[model samples]
Target: MKSEELTGNLHYQIFGLRSLYNLPDSVVKKFELHYASLPDSTIAKDTLLSVIINRKLKNSPYIFLRKKDGEVVTIYMENSQYQQFTKFKYKELIDNKQEVCIKLKAEKLMGRYYKCISVTSVKIKKGQTLGKQGKFLLYEYE
Candidate 1:
């Protein structure tokens, strides 16, 4: 939906929900516990805030979330949209888990970029690529 279609507060709430999804499962549960304690007015500040994590697509990085009424959403906000957050940096990859984890700062600007760590344990066809460059990082395997 276009930014003009939703009220500012409504838009924030939806985007907030998307941000919450980036958090680890434990943190999201804590947020739910706290949110549940707020007044009815605050809890229902935006109807679209009622969303839950849905499945991720196989072999793709996209993550899907669904609302109570079955409306689905993606955690695909652009890097420029949330200045408060950072993207993963190439330097940080060495510290991240072998599978991967998330940081506000990301490695590549577009498509996917993989700075491979273990070349011997796993084999990729010498010329094959695991990821691409893109405007955003859809999801990181932690």
Candidate 2:
């Protein structure tokens, strides 16, 4: 299995959202102060924006199979279950191709206090090369 991370301007949204998702307890506490002033409906969202992209991996650390409504499932018994769920969700659209490219974006409209915005995914076509944010690395078997 070979895996790599995508880090570029296009992925900034992913990076930002993940940063918010993994915020420290102390930071979250501070945000809670601001959160208190928000309306009741704003607090009910619970910070989860949405599932932008969902897909599986054929040769990487995770595997892909569709769930309800063709949603990708990462919990392939053959693959490790400890994989961390993150902001970007890449698809497994190619089986014989070398690699795939995934693009994502998010949008959140609450009050001025909070927002989580993002896009979805796109698999790189065969013979196509990586775009600005695409990266390739050898993934080690876990």
Candidate 3:
């Protein structure tokens, strides 16, 4: 399938709540020294300030694996007793279009450390049409 990266300035909030999900070892190590003096509760909410975007090919029976920059699609078949696969579709909304733009930003909070402060994704005025299919089926967007 043909694909291209469009420009967007969308904003997203990425909160790292330890109660819900633990931060990865690499991330923890990266920020460990910076937040060492902070309380455990505060440390638990490590800031992951970045935006990730991805696209999928039509009729693809694959799983979407998110990465720091983009996404990867993988196809696998396992025994029903061990694993399962599900299909889904995407419904475009009036406020949500296919056009996209992106910008990344980071900042230091409380003069203590630098963290991802903002990620923007805006619509592209001259955006080209993506591969068209019967329906917009994707593994995930966020």
Instruction: List lDDT for all candidates, in order.
Output: 0.29, 0.29, 0.28
- Model 3 clash count equals 12
Output the number of the TM-score-best candidate: 2
Provide TM-scores for the models: 0.25, 0.26, 0.22
Of 1 and 3, which scores higher on lDDT? 1
lDDT of 3 by residue, 1-142 (tens): 2222322222111221211113456765656465556665653333321101011111112222222244322221122311221211123321344333433233322222222323333234333223224343432332
Candidate 1 lDDT by residue in tens digits, 15-96 = 2223453466788688768867877766443233432212211112222223234333333433333222233322243234
lDDT of 2 by residue, 75-134 (tens): 221222313223223332123433434432222222211111222343434632222243
Q: TM-score rank, highest first? A: 2, 1, 3
- Candidate 1 stretches with Cα past 4 Å from truth are 1-25, 51-138
Off by over 4 Å in 3: 1-98, 106-116, 129-136
Worst-scoring 10-residue span by lDDT in model 2: 6-15
lDDT of 2: 0.29
